[model samples]
Target: MYIKPLALLLAVFLASLRLAAQTAPAGHVVVTHLDSKLLHGNPGGENPRRRVSVYLPAGYEASPSQHYPVLYYLHGFTWNDSLIFNQDGMKTLLDQAIAAGQIRPLIVVVPDEQTRFGGSWYTNSATNGPWADFTARELIAFIDKQFRTLAKPGSRGLAGHSMGGGGTVRLALAYPGTWAAVYALSPAFLGPHPSYLPGPGVGPALRATSAAEAQRVHTTLAAVSLARAFSPNPKATPFGANFPGSLGADSLARRDAVLARWVLASPLYTLPIHPAALRQLRAFAFDWGAQDEVKHIPPTCRQFSNLLAVYGIQHTAEEYEGTHGSRIMGSTGRVYQQVLPFFNKHLDFSP
Candidate 1:
């Protein structure tokens, strides 16, 4: 379908006016969704909606005729399109990064990938929801048609944190041709680790004790839901059910199956399937706080790095010293620093 670039720009610009009243910084942008009534439930499902927040560099207006590569960012659970992507502080961070020569000028788009069960994990699922298609097809098409972006995979980068970090890893694996570089920050659980058992705190975190508590405590339950939701074993667990499958022996087995599925989907497990995809990548980087609450930060980082090493997939993995939430604020600037250069190194902006 044809999309008007000016129309998309106007829509976001107006939304930004409204967003300015919120707590976000001065230049906070708005991310909007355009649903496809016609394509709903097809391979990409109908309702091909695009939720995009764009950050243009300081001289974006002066150089009105210029075009730039785009950065696609996915937000964590509980955060809608506007929270991280459209926030004004992030825009200022980009501005500072560009000014300091830490990174080249570029556009960053953050979209909402949260599905019915809290988050899609950016995966397509009956249980977790159709976020994969929403992201890979719908969002990309809309942004390209409506923006002045350099409409090519090599000109693009994808990154996220927490649930979004999983989305980044999952999307990079699923559509190896879509992005030239990727960055993930403090990603959630990958799969069960026999050697990496959870601490006693994990009991409260996993909520393995009770169903209601599970719903309240277990963020890992989203992993299970994404498993059944996106890639289902219908025979193993019934459709449209809460994750961890209602807390019984059968439920536990089903949850384990979900974990097995995660292992299959994880970058650590499936990097071999897309060796060329990995090779095409200009950069792959992920970092987590040494004291991250959700997952064992160091081990997970090592796991991904070791897997990359085995496949000769060059990547950068670091263990920063911070927690999940706070570090993202401090590190987003650094992420832009890493990402913009990666794109500059890979994507040729000249026509």
Candidate 2:
């Protein structure tokens, strides 16, 4: 199993921003919530619907008629859903950056992607619940329908970090026509590890267990969750590692088979032949920290980058020094800048 390392340089940039946050000017923070009943699965009846935090660029509220390109920002694990509007001084930084000419006037939508575990691999799974569909189909559809968005693939951008980084890639693959650009920040690469642990697959299953046991099970089940989320097999159970429902030696064999499938789907592996898909992509890029403890990222990223080169997929991949947590703010800010500008360059935003 290979884990991608976080970048160290991004951490330094985030640290500097943290210090700057102490004395920042006021009245620049912006937060607005959209009632996502469209994503609630029911149009009527008072049920708890998801709320999306919309961060407008400077002069957005003042210029009501002006429409802006939309950037769908997926949150990594361990984030407060409410903080889609708050937390990490994100709104303030976005406001400041837009004001400072660091980025363009765009609509930023931050949606929570956290589940029972620290994060959702952002793949629709019978085991991991409805996150994949919620994000890929429901969330994106809802945002486009309600908002004054530049509703086109070229005008849309997708991005995330860690678990969300994996999600950004997964979703982009699932819906290649949905986004023109994607930015993965410190993406968690699930190398060629065979997913053997299991629980549920995808579909509704009720196997009640104690909360303590659930947590305990996660030790073995985390890989299963990642697999089920990323590469699902509804026929397999507990769940499928390679094939479905085998044990001991047979399961291991099946697991190896499944790992091959994962390698095929990985950006590092498949981008070489799918030049059309890669070409459809306006921008594809990712960055990691040099101090990142996870060692697999550099090789995996390089492999993916090299494959992109074979297909003539123009992209920017880099490694900077930073850890997992320290680089979120700056990396996020940079991604937003890159993502929006890519859309601006590709899309005819002349409405």
Candidate 3:
């Protein structure tokens, strides 16, 4: 029998992974599969049982009686809740930071919010389910009950990258009582930027012959994903969301309708509406890469930072030297230097 070359390689690779797991580090990465009631009846019929990645510091088990602060990390579009070994190992990175006293020993939680359309945007909508509610209520309650967490608003922080970064903004504005501090890295679609709307590449996704081509086509699926997240109309076409004539005519009226929905969902548009919520945050910070591949992101980041100033909100925003995904992870990245220090400076770490 002749096996495909890729299949043979995959089998060998998986076996190697199994061998490595046998010698896996003593670092704590709790794998908890949680079934959420909020996502139970999604229009997209996505699985409610989500696997969350939790990182507990070295001393967590030794000091069982002690409670620690929590930081919830949301991953970017098309990316799941993890960074692998070569990506500077999520557990190893934290262990090193704690060992160096760079930051306080704490628990970090990451949820699998990837959906059939690629991402949930960490927002509540009829198409993708109540993602925001699931995080703010169910996930938090479960973590608190199952771990020795400092379970309160003052002790919790929220952060994300790319789409996840935008989620930090959405969650802070909509559910300020859940986390005290928040940060975003290279957030997208800030204040209804039109550059993100779907283009012709989305139309070719259906006919894509190769996986790589399909992946390229899938980038444009953000149109479908964002529509499902923002202006979800269960009775509408295109995955039960009004994707502004995605498969139909791209008319001016249709584009306007879609843009209107985007504004309603944008943090920039909602910033004024939730002045009190933004002010209530113990700390708020976000940054972007000056050389971000996503051309509109750098400017949009500025737009958001400027808007924050206009509203008299106290927050920190900066532009660093890197690309959208370049400076996010590993030891020499924003996660290690900027994000962690920001949280440590703000989040309550008192025993």
The candidate that wins on TM-score is 3
Model 3 CA lDDT for position 2: 100
Report model 2's TM-score to 2 decimal places: 0.71
* Candidate 1 lDDT by residue in tens digits, 1-351: 776999999989978745543432233354566674423553322234545677766566677788778888788866766666446257766655555455667777887654433566777655333568778877788888876788888788888888788788878878878887888878765444543232222223233443344345334444434444445543442234333223444323234554455567665666677767777787888878787766555577778778788888788888877777754663354465555555556665654
Model 2, poorest ten-residue lDDT window? 202-211
1-351, model 3: which lDDT tens digit per residue? 999999999999988755554553345888888989889988777899998988887778888789999999888888777653224366776766666556788999999888877789999998789999998889999999988999988899999989889898889999967898999989877775546554443454433444345445555466567777887888864456665434445432345686578777888888888988889998899999999988778988899999999989999999999999887776688888888888888899975
The estimated TM-scores of all candidates read 0.74, 0.71, 0.86
RMSD of each: 11.0, 8.9, 9.8
Each model's lDDT: 0.63, 0.58, 0.80
CA shift of 167, model 1, Å:
1.4
Model 1, residue 58: what's the lDDT?
57
Rate residue 10 of model 1 by lDDT: 94
In terms of lDDT, which candidate is stronger, 1 or 2?
Answer: 1
Model 1 residue 191 distance off true place after TM-score fit, in angstroms: 3.8
- Clashes in each model (backbone N, CA, C under 3 Å)? 13, 17, 0
The number of clashing residue pairs in model 2 is 17
